[model samples]
Target: MRLTAEQIASFHEDGFLVLQDWFTPDEVDLLRTETYHEFGNDQPGRILEKNGAVRTVFAAHKSNDVFSRLTRLQKMAEPAAQLLGDEVYVHQFKINAKLGLDGDQWEWHQDYLYWLKEDAMPTPNVLSAVVFLNTVDDFNGPLLLIPGSQKMGTIDLDVEKKYQQLDVAESWKPTLTADLKYKISKRTLIRALENSRIVAAKGTPGFVVFFHGNTLHASAGNLSPVDRLSVFISYNTVANALQPIANPRPTFISERDFTPIAALPDDALLAPRNGHSSPQREQLASLAG
Candidate 1:
């Protein structure tokens, strides 16, 4: 769906926008099924927890048809293009399955920091579309965003202690171990946002949240009984593709494809089963099959 002028303004001001029921129930169900059935630990970019539960599955769009289409939908891509002010391409695709107890904490940091430091992304011309496959609420460990932080530019290293770009380029790799602390000083983050109220990224199934690439955000470990599943699709402007680097990450982490995204029809995911002639019949079929 096309974004409203007000929505765009809000995003620029707050660094994020939440869309309720962006996808229909049938669509959410179809995608949720794919999340559990289509992913496995054998993949190159998969990261598991200490208990061996899948924490993040990267590059699902490249392998799964449903996800491949979902990421390119005009509902998401169109708005991303408007925000980036250029044609967009997929930079990263991942699914986070924060299982009941295995859902680990993701430290406070901006996504642009990761893309800039490790992935060799030149500018902050990227954004992420987060879709809730399962309900996200306070107890389930919703993502937290510090509003208006994107306007501060990239929050990072001290000038004197800065890593030489060449030295950092040759040696550093993206690792989740202390990932949150690595991007920014956790203690410093606490002090900077001491006056700001945190926004919990909670929503129902089919709900979507879009945040700027440089938005300061984090998620807590799941302590609730039920699991939380969220789909994150990142879009980078084709002109802002990865820059030359001394060492590069796997293609799954930083996609090599710079093709402009083409969106499917709005109803593509909610389309009926073949041979279903009536709307009622289609509705029942979606629920049954």
Candidate 2:
């Protein structure tokens, strides 16, 4: 579960590292099933696209058994701790879905922007553990990331003008939508593109990509007939937890707990159902019952 020195160096250079088949197919099937179960709930955390398709479901780890175990899996937690060089806690957990033909485009932006502005996060000592729940290809919307873009640090933007209509109290919602409030301007993107190339994250259901928090990323609308679903678990260094904002976002969006996450056993997710083998087995049995 630990990352190699070469993989760590590559992540530092490119701001991302992809591990194909990081999870087994059986584990992926379990994750996909749990994702759909959470998606059917009528909760404020379930964001929808303009076309009425499910967009993103936030904080499922709090309510779903499978996702809760996923956050603590050794394979998922160890690398994040190694990369950040500190004990980490889950800052945000969500399932981002691109439904076939109905999914919308996400504009170019860094994931850290929302944390910087809304949560008052001090530094970018964070990373996202993205697990592919479905097969991703060119036809289906795949995440696009610029190589080494995280070294640019925080890109400046005029927030007042971009979100002039909404007050500061109400601006956090728009920033999470398709039309993001903190979008990277075309001129800035063009300049960055001059030095960096776009990488399409294409892989199968078990693929996992761990990207730096400040990495510039986005995705196109799904054009194919298949849906693309991915889990994004934002892991932040426990030392650099939020500093408190006046109008903080909901718990689902910005987790309030600063407790460092303890990694469960490697087989926590797919442990045998014979019982007494995994700490997660009791929860899974409860859900199944």
Candidate maximizing TM-score? 2
Clashing residue pairs in candidate 1 are none
Per-residue lDDT of model 1, residues 126-208, tens digit only? 99999998889888889899888887798765322333443543333334532432456767677658766689988789899
Please provide, for model 2 over 170-242, each residue's C-alpha lDDT reduced to its tens digit, 9 standing for 90 to 100: 7677977898878798887887788889999998899999999999999999999898989999999999999
Top candidate by lDDT = 2
Instruction: Mark the regions of model 1 whose C-alpha exceeds 4 Å error after superposition.
Output: 158-174, 177-181, 271-289
Query: Can you give the lDDT of residue 188 in candidate 2?
Result: 79
lDDT value for model 2: 0.88
TM-score of 1: 0.86
- Local accuracy by lDDT, each model: 0.80, 0.88
How many residue pairs clash in all the candidates, one count each? 0, 0
- lDDT, candidate 1, residue 117? 75
